[model samples]
Target: MKRYLPLAALLVSACATEPAQDLYAIETAPIPAAVETAPMVGKGDKADDPAVWVNLANPAASLVLGTNKDAGLYVYNLAGEELQFLDVGRVNNVDLRGDLAVASNDETNSVSWFTIDSTTNTVSHIGDTPTNKDEPYGICAGLVGNTYYAMPTYKDGVAQVWAVATDAISDGPELLAEIQVGQYGQLQLEGCVFDEANGQVFVGEEEHGVWKLDLNDWTAAPVSVDTIDARNGLVADVEGMDIWAGENGEGYLVVSSQAADRFVVYDLKAPHAPRGVFTVVESLDGAIDAVTHTDGLDVNSAPLPGFPNGIVVVQDDGNPESGVDQNFKLVDWTLIQAALGLE
Candidate 1:
């Protein structure tokens, strides 16, 4: 039931001075969202990033965790209905591996931990541990072998890796190493994703582009996978990133072209060639508005009710309603693959 749109032949070339639209070419037709979550309470530039939690037992019962930078975290169901909202104070970027959900807590200047209870369809706050970086901006977590590492990135272009012991959430998220991710005159850094299959992490330096860091050797210099270039479909201020997991490290790395209101896909393997560029337009039925000025996004390949091939959830900075606050939109992943001609 995947819908394949006609591909456009006009690819974006290098440009010295042009409008934002000309900076990144839209390679495919506009993709619409299948679901949109309830708007957050805190108005104006509050809703930031989102993380999806899959339910193996019941796919329809999966949950989406979103951050309200002015408030806390909001959990919603597959239908985009709010199930619960936790006012944990300025919880920014969020990510999850297995059942452990973690977020960068700006209020406490630490990394907050939460345990996912699938049976009850809820995320319970366990505790938080202080981070070396003050007021961590973005975070992504994953298990390297058997140990869980939570990486909290800062506004000063620095990132720190902390190992968390799940059995003892309150014990310690021992600080392992500190990394200076600033390169290419990067003063601000946020939005990151863990590539567990490759034993590496991708960090977004807002004004520059994405950098690939080796988790094994923290001292190894970061490699530039791609940068803010019009030819590669990236505009300045690159934001949220997530992986569409595939077999044996075969997949696509989706990064938010924040300034262009589009998402750019690159080959998940070495070289990281550009695959395609797309934007989420208003729903066909006009129920949900287009996603613009997105901050953070998460993609899951697990089959869900309407999203048989899984879905990508992104923060919608602008809601169409007169007074409704910002929210997140859900797009079927199969539509993206077909539109982008991805395998």
Candidate 2:
């Protein structure tokens, strides 16, 4: 009986450690029946990604910079008015560094530089990064001290993090470190971000899960921290990622599951072992593609009135022929908070 007692206790503990079933079940409130539709800047061009720049003087009036895949970057006002477009055709990812917006062209194997005039909401093409590899998908900028770190999706199955100075753009991004992630058949690397506060960078592989690497020690290889399986109606092709900090400067990691038409949220307070995966349902009417394969996300602090904190913006790859409506959607975090019982 004593031996049986020990075995029973072990089984109970194992079951207790398992993630709660309801963690992945998201209770979503219907987005207002009338979904606001933004105008498409160009035809046959999918609106890929977006970043927000707050107008400090007038928080009510902010700017959103969106990537028009294969066309260029488009700037829009808070009311979704198209301000301007700079044609530097890029197919992959786009990001901002101060007043400069950087775009990666996977097919061309290049990154383009542009200076954005915030006041006028215009972008000027400065130059392009010396080309490399076949497809450079994921690109993000992180400030380490005074230098800016640029990460580009590398071909041949690895991603390179570069240390770029003002002049380093012409010579191509300098190799700071390389992270080799497991490949799925022939699928390549996709979404990535550097969390400064955590002193680590998160990289997402198309067919695999997300990985975490410590920048303090570049030589240290990345380890798989989370595995996103295609279960519970969650999209298997994970693409974009963005970090949201809580009131105390600690928060969650939000990732997109392109095929399943959902976004998964993971609590990052535990670092190694993340908890709670919440799904956000895509608007059936606004889905740009047959599947709400959402790509690219940017969270703004204090975006709308009353909601002083902020909101998240996501891109829809409108494939109307297949029942997808190409457009961007503003996700009210306040609504998310209420769903998570935070409210």
Off by over 4 Å in 2: 1-37, 41-45, 154-156, 166-173, 183-187, 230-234, 247-249, 272-291, 302-307, 319-325
Cα RMSD to the true fold for all candidates = 4.9, 8.6
For candidate 2, write residues 164-254 as lDDT tens digits.
7655555555766666764554446667777777778777776767777786887787776576553422345777787766655476777
Go through the candidates in order and give the clash count of each: 0, 9
- Those runs of model 1 whose alpha carbons end farther than 4 Å from true positions after fitting are 1-21, 24-28, 321-324
lDDT score of model 2? Answer: 0.63
Q: What's the lDDT for all of these models?
A: 0.85, 0.63
Candidate 1's error at 107, in angstroms?
0.8
TM-score versus the correct structure, for each prediction: 0.91, 0.78
Q: How many backbone clashes does candidate 1 have?
A: 0
